[model samples]
Target: MSDSIFSIPIIAGTFLLAGVVKGVIGLGLPTVAMGLLGLVMPPVQAAALLLVPSLVTNLWQLLAGPRFGALLRRLRGMMLGIALGTVAGSGLIAGPATGAATTALGLALAAYAVVGLFGPALRVPPRAEPWAGPVLGAVTGVVTGATGVFVIPAVPYLAALGLARDDLVQALGLSFTVSTLALAAGLFWHDALPLQAAGASLLALVPALAGMALGGWLRARVRPGTFRLCFFLGLLALGGELAWRGLG
Candidate 1:
C-alpha cells in the first residue's frame, strides 16, 4: 500500500471521531467514518478501508459484556432479516448499480434523520412478534453491502425498543459486528477486498480504539436526550454527504 502523508492522519482523525460517537451512542462509527473517509478517497475504497477498524471496535463493544442471549432472543427475527438483506445486497455490488443503490441509501438515511428530528413520537410496542425487523434488516443489509451505508431503518427500531442505555449500545454493537463481518466476507469472496485497502483499515484501529475509550467515559455523564440528538445530527450530516456524492 502506497502511503500518502495525508491518508493516515485523515483516517486516524476520522476513526477517532467515529469511535467516540459509537462509544457514546452505540452506533454511528461506520456512518461517520465512511462519510469522512469518502471525502479523502473513493467511496468504495473508503468503505473497504473501514472494515477492520469497524470490526475491531465492534468487538470491543461486544466485550463490554451485555446480555447477548437476551438481545438475540428479542431481535432474532430482525437479525435474520438483516442477514438475508446483506447477502442479497452483496450480490448487487457490481458496476453502476452499486453506485446508484448507495446514493439512494444515503438519501433514505437523511430522510429518516429529518423525520426523527421533526416527526411524531415513534412507538413500536414490544410484541410477541414484530415484523419490521425483517423488512428493515433487508434494506439495511443491502445498503451495507452496496455502499457500506448501514444505519438506516435499524436505528429507529432499536430506538423504539426503549432499551436501557447499555443494552441498546450492546445490541447495536453486536449487530454491526455481525453485519460488517458478513459484508467483509462477501467482499473477500468476490475479490473486492484489496490488500492495500485492508491494511489501511487495520491501521485505523488505533484511533478508533482510543476514541472509543474516551467516548465511553463521556457516556457515563452525558444526558441521553442530548447524546441522541447529537447522534441523529451526525447521521444527518453524513447521510447528506453520501447522497450528494452518489447523486452528484
Candidate 2:
C-alpha cells in the first residue's frame, strides 16, 4: 500500500463516505470503505481501517436500545456461530495472499449485493430459531473473517426474526459490534494488524463520526429506500470491479 493513500485527505474522505452510509442506513460503512479502499490498498488493510469506526458506532447504537440483554440471550446461537466461524476463517483473510483475500472480499460483496437486490424474503419460525440462528451466525462469521464484511445472511436473518423497527436496529448494532471485535481478534492472532494500522483505524474514526452526523441529518430529509437503492447500485459496480481484479 502506498503511504500516500493514508494521507489525511484520502482517509478522511473514505471514512466520511462510509460513515454517511452507515448513519443513514445503520449499516454499510465497512462495505463502502472496503470497496473503495481496496482500490488503493490490500483487503486486510481495508478491513483493519474499518475496525475502530465500526466498533464505536455499533456500540453506541447497541446501548441506545432497551433490549440488549434480551437480544443477547435470543441471539446466543448465532453469536457463538459467528465467533467460531470468524476464528476459523480469519487466517485466510489476514494471510499473506492478498489475491485470495481480495477475491473473497469481492465475492462476498457481490453476493451481499445480489441478495439485497434480488433474494427472497427470509422468514424463520419461532420453533426454528434454535437451529437457524447459529447456522446464519456461523456463515456470517466466516464471511466476516474471510472478507471483512459481515452482513449477508446475518442481517437478513435478523430482519426475518420479526422484531420491531427499533429492536431490529439495536440488534443490528449488537451484531456489528460483536463482529468487529471478532475480526479484530482474528487479525491480531494472525499478526496482520500492527500497531500503526490500529492507530490509523482509530484516527479514521473522526471522519466517520462526522459523516454519520451528516447522514443522520439527511435521514429525515431523504428517503431511505431511495438512498438504499443508490447504495446497492454503487456496491454492485464496486463489487464487479473488485471481483475482476481479484480474478485477474
Q: Which candidate wins on lDDT?
A: 2
What tens-digit string does per-residue lDDT give for candidate 1 at 1-248?
Answer: 33788777888899999989877767778878766766555556766778888888877777686598898888887777777777666655534464665576567567667866776657677662477776777777877777676667777777777788788878887778878887787677767778888887888889998998998899999986798787778778877877777776
Candidate 1 is scored at a TM of: 0.85
Model 2 scores worst on lDDT over the 10 consecutive residues at: 1-10
lDDT for 220 (candidate 1): 96
Worst 10 residues of 1 by lDDT: 93-102
Best by TM-score: 2
Residue 22, model 2: Cα distance from true site in angstroms: 1.0
Model 1's alpha-carbon lDDT is 0.75
TM-score of each: 0.85, 0.97
Whole-model Cα lDDT of every candidate shown, in order: 0.75, 0.89
